[model samples]
Target: MDRSFYSRSSLIINTIESTISGDRVFTGNQPDDFALAGLLRNTKTACLLGVGYGGAVRAMLAGDPSIELTLVDNDAALIEFTGNLFARSFPGVAFTSETADAGSHLREHPGCYDVICVDLYSAVGYPRMVLDVGFWHDVREALTENGRVVVNAWGLPEQLSPLAPPSPQHAVAQAMLAVWQDLSHLPCRRNTTFVAPALTPADLRPPVDDASTRLSYEDHLTLGLIRLRGASAPVLLRGGIGDAGQPAPTSRRAIDAEMHARWPGLVEAVTGRAEASADFRAALSERKLTDAATERLLLEGSPAASFAPCIASAKAQLGELSMAWYGEWLCDEWFRLKALDPDWFRMSALWQAVCMARTPLGAVWPWEARLYDMLSAELLDAGFADAGV
Candidate 1:
């Protein structure tokens, strides 16, 4: 592993990358950092496990300077470096750095923290304790009555297509679910941040007067709330469709039928609207018409006449980019119709499009990400009939 540090604005970003793979093993100040900070808004004392460059520490302090944080890591040098850096950056915040294994620290200090963040990772992957049910029990025991535990687990399959082979994160998620009641996981790109016992929207709201942190807090809270929708239960439960304990969908028809049963007429209506818009655009291109001429032609005879209501309803409901992506998905689906698995087409296509449209800077537009979450929630629901632990 190789470590590097950089300064951005007022924050110092510490990153560790894999020497062999050259991929980031840990990086501070990501979206997940802000999300965790929002969760810790009202917390007084918190413990961070696997203090990789103190990203969470910086974020939590930024959100609530009064938070007393304890950083635990087995690496003495890393702990010392982080401790010294924070001592300079935040002159008077209450925090401590201890060089110790996270599990041992948790066992020694049961019921000691208001919030506990588990972010143990290495160049190889998540440590064995992360996937151990017994470790999770220790985590539960360490929390106060109303205390919350958030685990930063990576390599989770996307929520929309939950059929991938289970990763280490899946095992950790399973372990957490087994140990804690009301656990919920929020998927952000390839990482899924798991919190337990479940949090409500009100629990994640930003402080009224903290305008500087408001946008980041709200963005994360929006994702958190979207994950709370009832339809997200299955993906949350199994960590994807075919993990160890959950049964697969059986067949494409079964998956499609389930989707229709959950949200009747929604898929049909949206697809129809997209198809209508695509046809209208094709006609305009064929005629080589200006906007004025297109309006005159529409007055003569509407190209999307049959789907007028669907088009109008979709336009009213979806944002302009969302509608455009919806049409783009429809066009791609047409070519894939013969080879498409219904589940893949119905659930994953639009999601893949959203992922592809992410900005050059690697950030998804907030509204587009919200649209994906809303659409995904409507397309799938709980009750995977043979899919229980």
Candidate 2:
């Protein structure tokens, strides 16, 4: 897709036959070009459900011109527009265009595509069908043996509301998890491309022949892949859709109490190991005197004070470590501690912290402030933030 198709302006709206069709309102950066390029990599045949200006089709064709592409959209005007645009832009590539409902098309054609890209969205938001579990079941049944489904989903809510109905993005994610073997997310600032049967970062490369397409794919991977499973997956998926899990704490004291109860031995489990590590002790000893003094004030003699200094010193020595460092460290700790207390570690504050830390700097989408708030509550209750550590 060309740069013009990827609109930076979120306010731009396009209509087909007086029906609101395309806009960046709920789905920011709809038809994520780089994300589509990554998902369609190495695919022989692909079906694109929603054709908005043919950006996704252009991207898929650009990556691999020989792909047997199929375009399905409810709007005849869009299919015609895309056909005309492609005639001028990509005269050599051939693709079948069908005017039909996405769900009906998937039901009619089963196990035909190596890759199915679902970018279905109405003017209001994701249509009711996209949120239904039965719809995802149909999507799963339609996939080839090793087929992958890539969805352009709205960004997930930072913190799920227990009382509120799940957002379209969250509902879709949970539904996919229920039906698919695995689910992974390629998150951007606004829209997140969700992939079923989780793909790794290594799988996000473009065809070697297309240098520009390769560059675009590489740029999108900077944020990295978010595997949605274990604690990282939303709690609502515990017993499928209507189960909200536990109610979120409404007050500060209640939230702290919940955190303390959730991870009873978190501080001791993580920090004890850190304190015992000779490398951490050596690193702390080598810190500059001024820096050590500042960190000591930050530590303030908490239980984790000894090892927290090591983290501070490491940050100071390394200049500025990306949040990836913290994310990786958190994951390692979670795995190590989970064996001892599986229930305690599952869906605990640590995972929330990991999610927050791993998010690319400056790319955090709207409604994500709650992630930071949750992490803060954990740190405070665990005595890390209270001591300024």
lDDT of 1: 0.47
Candidate with the greatest TM-score versus the true structure: 1
TM-scores for all candidates: the values are 0.53, 0.49
Stretches off by above 4 angstroms in model 2 are 1-30, 33-42, 155-165, 201-206, 210-242, 245-389
lDDT (0-100) at residue 67 of candidate 2? 70
Q: What is the C-alpha lDDT of each candidate?
A: 0.47, 0.47
Cα error, residue 31 of model 2, in Å, equals 2.1
lDDT of 1 at 208: 27
> Clash number for every model?
1, 0
| Candidate 1 local Cα displacement, residue 60, angstroms | 2.4
Candidate 2 lands at a TM-score of 0.49
- Regions of model 1 farther than 4 Å from truth: 1-14, 17-34, 37-42, 92-94, 157-165, 213-389
Q: How many backbone clashes does candidate 2 have?
A: 0
Candidate 2: minimum summed lDDT over ten consecutive residues — where? Answer: 17-26
